[model samples]
Target chain A: MVTEKIIKVHAPATVANMVCGFDILGFAVKEPYDEMWIRLTEQPGITIINKDDYQLPAEPEKNVAGAALLAMLEELTQPVGFELTIRKHIKPGSGVGSSAASSAGAVVAANTLLNGVFSKEDLVRFAMNGEKLASGVKHADNIAPCIYGGVTLIRSIHPLDIVALTAPPLFVTIVHPQIEVRTADARSILKKQVYLKDAIKQWGNIAGLVSGLLQSDYALIGRSLEDVLIEPVRSILIPGFNTVKQKSREAGALGGGISGSGPSIFMLSKDEATAIAVEKVMQDEYQQLGLDHHTYVTTIHSSGVEIIKA
Target chain B: MVTEKIIKVHAPATVANMVCGFDILGFAVKEPYDEMWIRLTEQPGITIINKDDYQLPAEPEKNVAGAALLAMLEELTQPVGFELTIRKHIKPGSGVGSSAASSAGAVVAANTLLNGVFSKEDLVRFAMNGEKLASGVKHADNIAPCIYGGVTLIRSIHPLDIVALTAPPLFVTIVHPQIEVRTADARSILKKQVYLKDAIKQWGNIAGLVSGLLQSDYALIGRSLEDVLIEPVRSILIPGFNTVKQKSREAGALGGGISGSGPSIFMLSKDEATAIAVEKVMQDEYQQLGLDHHTYVTTIHSSGVEIIKA
Candidate 1:
């Protein structure tokens, strides 16, 4: 019998810039995950394989998974190579951290093959390369939660400080309206400057949100889940966004908003029933708009890239 | 002995905007309290007595405490009159919540006499009137902490939401440089608009600060005690502000910034020894600059207005 060095992992999906915590807060979800397998290769270079219909690049540099692996391999003192296979269940451009799952998945699998030598922060650092490849910038909002699991706060990026925050149990309902919102367009549309008053309100909301999560105050959480800056503008890009969100809250969601750059909307509820009910609200709203959409009812993922077969 | 029908309360000083949380976060301190006595009277109007040489106005409309009392009085269905005596230990224009102590003291005292008829939120609403009288704008950063005690986040003003936050054991050191930076001048110097990037950073810090305080993570709190918006502009108004803050950090204080608008600065330390050490640094820095200053070493006051003598 041959002793084969292979690692298979499940990397969860994530929601970034959660409501008032734009560019800072994010959390991993239980469903809509990506599966990846890594094998130690005698071939001194990386090999990429795509099993999904996304028809993603097999070239190491162009691929999200490949790009993330390349960054981690560079940090190793001893040379190592990996053969990567990706099966992405999370649809690309779904506004639910599709790129992050691919990026975080590859690095997490490669790290296991390397005997878990890299820290979660190191893995996040390598994974951000994939985000850069996907979005033309290195952002950890999605990558951090996808790698660290649970709810994560990207306190600072310059030195890379990640604060893993504990939140009360929550059910997440997501609806993707099947609209293409280029990340660049979302970035460009935001005003270069905002009123100081608005900024203060935004931070005040951020503070309240953090406090609510820490204290497990659901009402406070609902009150703080407001975005005065990005949501007002980017929400215009997603049809039925306001209706979906308002109706979801009416259906019993604590509160939620656009996931990442969006076209997808997410709502948080205290129970699975409410989450499912919120999901129905999303499905109905987009259905009435005659827009193609997808919805998921899930919970906050506890662990980031779960190891399957090692 | 006949009942005196008098209420004497001690209102502690507070530090508003506690670094990156401008217009949102604040905390009460134990020392530098204002002693006030509110007497039930049948005069059917308000009477003001000043025990200090600050020469504050005797007119109810012109006084901070009086203004706050007047606001609360309007809400009462039946007519109520009071004779208010104020002996303020917190200096006016020192930026250490001097006006807040007066306002909160009067309101808390009034509420106790009313048998706690109003909630903390109601008292905050009334106290904001004092803030308006003092600074021409109703702000609760100071009033919230001065009334609720410990740390408070004024989540919103229009709707009036106050979230009392629990913080880890900590010491507060304050320095008043005896120079006056008018509230109007301090506020007018701030930019009406801030860069979106900077605003993101500010909110990120606020999130981290709130998380740190709730989680009892001192290092996170220290890291988050940074203000890129208000501090840069307001610190210029306080002589030796930079040196006092920098030297205090070097002496092992966690981190801190301008207490409120300016002139008075506050530092947080893990213990009393460090707080006193930070105080000495404050004193030395101001002394070297040949500026007379006052310093206090205190802790967070868990109860807002302590009834010294009922």
Candidate 2:
């Protein structure tokens, strides 16, 4: 039997810590994905073939994609060697789950090459090892959505339960400003103890947001997008975050807030025209601050990692 | 136009603090309702009539139903008088939103008699004044569900927003072990500061529960009903709580925990047969403890505070 030489996969970027659901909910976006190519090797060690504009580590163990593939390799009964090549388009530290894309993509490509031995949930579990390497905390918020696509709820981390929720065809506007905000720093700013009252409100909004997505209620989704806890503290780290959010709402975004931990802001709209309008408002706010930013107008990507070439 | 002399309404009992939702979520049950009769009077002050089995206050201002009526009356432009008669079936301190039935029923009945003057939101706002009289703390968990029916989420207290979620036909098994567990006392036992990790899990469960209800996913609803925070503390107050819950689940209940701030334990099941089976387990547990208990097999009430006779 002849073994397949090469397999390539694409994993879309995900929005983590969606509005009211900090570390609990996430969903995938259409654009800004990372592509990975894996080739079977004779040597019994992993190697990174290319390094892009982002300063990804050349060492396989240190690299995000390499770390994920290494974790997945541990479970295989037979030893396998692969050289992984990653073309990273999703910017690192942009709060759009850049590392997750690489990690999920690599594992997916490798799993396909190895005759698909793992389930999607198993892939997510394996990919989380790399996520832990990238972001210290072994949370599945980004990886779950990046692997499953659509809106996902991380019900319990200890039990590792993830639920894929039904959602409408909603347009997304994301603006990633050219500024670095470390996830650790963004996390450090949050209070360890939140007011119980605030927690109640946050949970209520989370329930509402889930309902809004399932029901395709644009107004309810907008109303439930108010985050009283995490965003208030982290929004200060991003330049002109408030202005962009306000202008996005003014320009007809259903709702929006800081995407993930920092510099990137995202909004959801009901229509393509509103999404385009929301993008202009975000661009205008960032442009006024004389900041270079990349904005993408896209829709919710319901499917996560996919094989592009084999 | 000749105004009707009497308006009577039935307010169904509600289960508040639904598992992981703490102070924000609630849903109504079909049985154990309170009936309120309101008659127009010549005098411009409130009066209470026909309080049975419960030592309700005669003083209109201090009475739960009367207080809610007074709050609603204040919004009336013209001076009007109402004499209220309460037929209370839901017992006080049952942890089944008994007081909320009275308050919500009164406002709903009076609002109907006054020619639909107040909106449902306004009715809830006024009913909360009465809830404060009953529980000392003004919370809308019970009142919102009792007023709006189905499963309701109290998204914001400041803005007083309530979202009614669509739910499938779900049967509920409730066992009230006749013991006094004051709402205030139940609340006092809880730790003021919960671990942030636990709060995150609770909120995630809240989102999942809402999604489960909307999607009518019975297994998901059962899975999401595990409360790691409030129930652990409050369950201690109820005798045979743990055994009842364990037995209920053993008997094929979807899931269950302490209902509200218990002496009452409730379980949700997909079918009436399972609900009935769950009730037997609950009864057997409390019966073995030689405690007086009342058990009901009911379904989710989709409408709340309806006029039985006008």
Tens digits of per-residue lDDT for model 1, A1-310:
9798889999999999999998999999999899999898888778998999998889999988888988988988888889989998998988899999999999989888878899999999999999999999899999999998999999999889999999999999999888899877888899999999999889888988989999999899999999999999999999998898889999999999999999789999999999999998988988899999889999998888899999
By summed lDDT, the worst window of 10 consecutive residues in model 1 chain B runs over: B301-310
CA lDDT scores, all candidates in order: 0.92, 0.88
lDDT tens digits, residue span A136-233, model 2: 88888889999999999998888888999989899999999999999888888888887777888899899889988998888889999999888889
What is candidate 2's lDDT per residue for B1-310, written digit by digit as tens? 9865788889999999888988888999999898889988889989888568788787878888888888888888889888889999999889899889999998898888877878999999999998899878889999999989999999888898899999989999999989999888988887877666778989988988998899888888988998988888888888888888888888899888877787788899989999999988987887789999999999889998888898
Show pairs that collide, candidate 1: none
Reference interface contacts recovered per candidate: 0.88, 0.81
| Backbone clash tally (model 2) | 0
Report the C-alpha lDDT of model 1 over B54-99, residue by residue, as the tens digit.
Answer: 9999899999999999999999999999999999888999998999
Residue pairs with backbone atoms closer than 3 Å in model 2 (clashes): none
TM-scores, one per candidate:
0.99, 0.96
Residue ranges of candidate 1 with Cα displaced over 4 Å: none
Top lDDT model = 1
